[model samples]
Target: MEFLQILDSDIRPGGLIEWIPAAPGGLGAWHRDPRGTSHNHEQHLRSAHDYRRATRREGGREAWLGLAVEFDQQIDFPAVQGALLAWINRHEVLRTHVRLDGPDVARYTTDPGTVLLRRSRIGWYHDPRLLIEQIAGSFDRATTPMHWPAYRFATVARAGSFTLFFAADHSLVDGYSLVNAQYELRELYQAARERRPAALPPTGSYVDFSSSERTAADAADDRHPAVAVWREFLGGADRLPPFGILPAPPTGAGPPPAQHSHTTLLLDDDATRALTDRATALGGSLIGALLAVAALVYHRHGGCRFTTLMPRHTRHHVEFHGALGWFVALAPISVDVSDDPDFALALERTMVSLDRAREGASLPMLRLAELIGIPPEPKFVVSFMDTRGVPGAVEADAGAAVALRSHTYADDEVYVWFNRTPGGLRLHSRFPAGGDGPGEAGLAAFLNEFAHLLASIAAGG
Candidate 1:
């Protein structure tokens, strides 16, 4: 095949190579050499969180983001390998290595051509789940400030089909960046197969964004409006609310186990459509409605107002749309269900609170913790990703079917992940099993109530 022939000279299986530079005076030239760059505020926050987690015995395992994409038909392995190299060459974030120069500072260095593309093959009978788990488990085995690459890629073959698995450090890419990279990889593969150059356009690098973020943070004063907003949100509270739905543990019980349990909730198509319509009529988003339902459920179960760490995509600039990097930040949204028992009113209030949060959405979570003198970790966190609207489905010329699979590791006391699938909205909740939080039975009951509340709100009750 032409693709195979093209890859013969470019693909280096389980070896390091000097990445070939694309045409000069284009996007390819933007990061042709390794250079030191300062870490952005968000990057600093992630680094600090990772460092803190490292202090625990089982802490560092959750730092990796794992993805697996399967194709129904056989794929050109070498061509795909070449595409991976090309994709890495285009994004400096993939080539970046983080090192702590001081107690509080992390410096990023980009090694342009030294990326090691490790490759391996799995048998047809190999279990996919075990492979994914193995990759995720070893993510933090090695210490940082080392020369290892930020990511690992592998190809697996199973009876005329193939699966591409990727695992990377959380500091390098977020959910949005992972999706963007998959899309770009598909395009690059197609172009490579056709013996034509990839049509990737120029975009700003993470280095540039980091420099700009540092400048903005330095220019802002302690009394800045955003900082004040965060301070007020904390309300002079010494500690954030607990995430458990059950009663609190006794004092001196010791810290909870670091492991988590997962539960999922699914809505049918009709229910999802109804909720979408209701959210539209209420002048809010489905995510907002869900959050409102969560707040109501937590209040009814725990009898108190609570705060959640809500993530916002920080790629507001046009140049960041197609770029791959960790461009996400979390905003703390406090919900008080006692103020309004009415579901509609509660949803409205939730929407308003979320809107206000957008005002300082760009602020780093670590900075907010420092300003308020609160613990950096939030008890409850919510994350949403809508992948149904991606531009195109991954399809190879050989008529192979492609599907993207994403997996997240949780480090919080409670984490809720929402994904918009073709059938409906899917919710996955991960919470500490032996912690002060809800146990298995309590969590199941909470999920049931959340579903019921969501349905009621969508029905305009």
Candidate 2:
């Protein structure tokens, strides 16, 4: 049995390595945090708790894997499980976690989560009635994170048999990882059931890549492009912008469900083609166009300019770029939403800024915080990514698949995020539930208007 090795992201080279044993019941998992020190760990947990507790003002609030196949032909559990494991093995990050203490301590995964191969009719019960109830139950009972750990997976019985699900802490994995895992699991399961050889790829270990990345970051004399982008865009703008998106709730109030619901906008082949063509014409990429609209929405909401933090994987150029460990650099960039008429040109500028931040990604988050004079806990953070890995490319499956989806917590003060999928582009905004911030309806309406404005831009309206 392979064991999952957990590591602390914040630990410098030659740090201490602490090993925690996994619990029984075939629920094999562990928590790998970015902060290795006791102080940072406590602070991170507190931040997560606060995020969950503050959801009532704007709306309601707070916030898996497995394999098994139907005995029948339709749902292939074995295949899916096999594929997922293969993918995990293929991606170095999934296989490794930060070791708390060690010389050059990095991601190591001797322990992989338990993989159960079982038969069930749970998946085949596509009856709308049963399906909806089961899904609802899963949603209701699923544990929302009170803290940020590595990743997690769970499954439950609905109606006749059982259904498997994956619940991972977002801080550890992103949307692309989940999708790839799913694909790998499916492939692995099918091959096993059929008694055929599984064709798994050769992926590097997360530890190797992470340590290498730190080395590269430290060695690079240049600042990450994203940070540079932020510095240039801010151009003397306030590092700490005013908090106007939502207000905090009064003390001693019970937590409420967050009002911010996520929605994905798929740009079909035609739409993707049209948007990309126009974007190129306007001197921007698809991401540039999306940023323009997002800026517009932010401007309309508060007339304030703020930084949008994006995660860039540093696994690149390392031996284990595809590995599953947290080797990402978060660069928070501010776009001057208050200026410029041509949204395209504005997006181009933002893109340029992103480049700078990436270049200087070797600077640790804590170091950046110190340099910027911002605490770990800031106002809501808005992130944007072009998710081309999952459900990306209309040509992949004839374009009928749902490409883009997002999960965000209003538990913290943060409100919105923007992303791109195969279908189109989506703007995911999370508003406060209680009195902590804005509600989903208001945020949605705001996005709707902004979308229309972008449409006009696309149509030259």
Q: Rate the local accuracy (lDDT) of all candidates.
A: 0.57, 0.45
**Best-performing candidate as measured by lDDT:** 1
Minimal lDDT window, size 10, model 2: 1-10
Compared with the true structure, model 2 gives a TM-score of 0.66
| Tens digits of lDDT, candidate 1, 55-133 | 5543333445544454555577667767887777787776655554455444444445645455543323244455544
Residue 441 alpha-carbon offset, candidate 1, angstroms:
2.8
Model 2, global lDDT: 0.45
lDDT (0-100) at residue 113 of candidate 2? 49
Score every model by TM-score.
0.78, 0.66
What is candidate 2's lDDT per residue for 8-104, written digit by digit as tens? Answer: 0011111111111233332235444342322222234344455556542211112222111212233344444554454444554444333323222
Q: What is the Cα root-mean-square deviation between model 1 and the actual structure?
A: 7.6
Off by over 4 Å in 2: 1-164, 215-244, 264-267, 301-306, 318-321, 360-362, 370-372, 387-412, 415-417, 434-442
Question: How far does residue 98 in candidate 1 sit from its true spot (Å)?
Answer: 2.5
Cα-lDDT of candidate 1: 0.57
